[model samples]
Target: MHDVTSQAGFASPDLSAFCRLDELGLVAVGQRLEPDRAVLACRVVEPDQWCRRCGCEGVPRDTVTRRLAHEPFGWRPTSLEVIVRRYRCSGCGHVWRQGTSLAAEPRAKLSRRGLRWALEAIVVQHLSVARVAEGLGVAWDTANDAVLAEGRRVLIGDRARFDGVAAIGVDEHVWRHTRRGDKYVTVIIDLTAVRAGTGPARLLDMVAGRSKQAFKTWLADRDEAWRDGIEVVAMDGFTGFKTAAAEELPGAVAVMDPFYADVLVMPMSVVFALLRGLSGAVRSA
Candidate 1:
């Protein structure tokens, strides 16, 4: 068998900079080479194990190897096979396993760094969940669930994300191009950054359906203070949207978006009348 302990010396390759297992109270014991990927075996650095129920020292028995998907190194996928020691409390006679920060929760297959990489791939890199799943070497449903759970915990669940709203925009978007069911959704945006000249607008919420009732219901769900802070609402030429704004945001000014006004406002008769006037002036000149 290949000795992993001998490879930990100075002559061995250093993966500490990228792996950073030390931060999680883990040390890389050895590496197993495979045709497709590399598996790094790790163990907790701390030798002493304590019992959770009673304040007593535990005796180390055997170890259980847990396989976890880790962040990729270069273009190749990497996995961590952690050997966690099982311990028996001398006083309480309780048995427990060693815990490390390598993974987020117990029985989770993805490491902490792997979870971060997956989130960045979806949010910052704009990659699909399937691609992220392939990179993490896991099933599609596993990757999707992990990414969505982490996203909700870190981003969507943030209470401060909705604060300081002064201006907004509402529009409808076609979510799906299918013949079966309703595929339209109402999109709400925070245009406060644009009005303040700070940054581009961001999507605030998306509601199902595209009607005055949908928009009105969304506005009604907001707090009174949030509703009162709206100073302006920009929308297209949809009369239903106008009516909804009038009912919900009576204090705010409703401005027609220039792009939509150009597309929906001018009639063919008005355009021909202006063209005739210009042609007559040119002929007289």
Candidate 2:
């Protein structure tokens, strides 16, 4: 009998089977590696569920449509054309459009495949979404939506499993550039042992504002276990973040390196080495 790992070797046909193609034509196109190890790529296509009001599948009086690309579940690239049909229910005469899918909302143009590519470029390669979209021959909205969607999706699971968080990093950057008004985003990082790998960083959250109230409310939502595990915080010299961390996570170390800047601005070689060191320390401790 072939060992499971041996059966899953790169050269084996199991790779293709891993990416199961459904009737709707979503295809798994790539694979990503993680240190802890999990399934590589397994893209599957699924049809949209019917509306409760009408009890009709893909039924429509007036058609409205949108498409979106979402982050891969594992190694599979994914995409969906989310359609919302405005239908007058034959039974009740009520007219309404259907709800959006949790995976991709209605009216988006990027496929889940496109989203994964864009995000991988941003997270692993440090390439901006704009550049990734440009290279992929897609629109700016597609790239931006992919980033936002992926960020939310990953954050949900990561937030649930987070524990033993000794240190954290809170920082902000301009998510979208506008020459005129305020367009900043705050990123909260969980520097914990579980995130010490080739997978994505321990992103706690991202919010639009740079306010004390916003950060305070956000910090207050965490459980005592996570809050207590945090021993140190490294952040830019932002008083709002510093204050929130101090107030919410008492007795936690606050490391302010005001001179350092965004992840994009840092050298890749240096960043990877430092991250590896952080990972090692976290794993050991």
Across 1-285, the per-residue lDDT of candidate 1 in tens digits comes to 887676676355556545877766677888887766778998877765888889799998899998888887764678888888999999999998887654556767788888888877766565666677778878777777776676556644766757999988887765444565667667677778877879766556667788999999999999989999999888887888889989999999999867433322222222222222222121211
TM-score of 2: 0.48
Best by lDDT: 1
lDDT of each: 0.72, 0.53
Predicted candidate 2 versus true structure: per-residue lDDT over 1-285, tens digit per residue: 756765566555643344333322434345445442222332333434344666755435875644454434442333333444466656666666654433334455654445555656666666655455555455555566556666557655564646656666776665444455555556666555322443333556666667876777877888777788888777777788888888998978887654223332343332332222222121211
Minimal lDDT window, size 10, model 2: 276-285
Deviation of model 2 at 265, angstroms = 7.6
User: Each candidate's root-mean-square deviation in Å?
Assistant: 14.1, 11.5
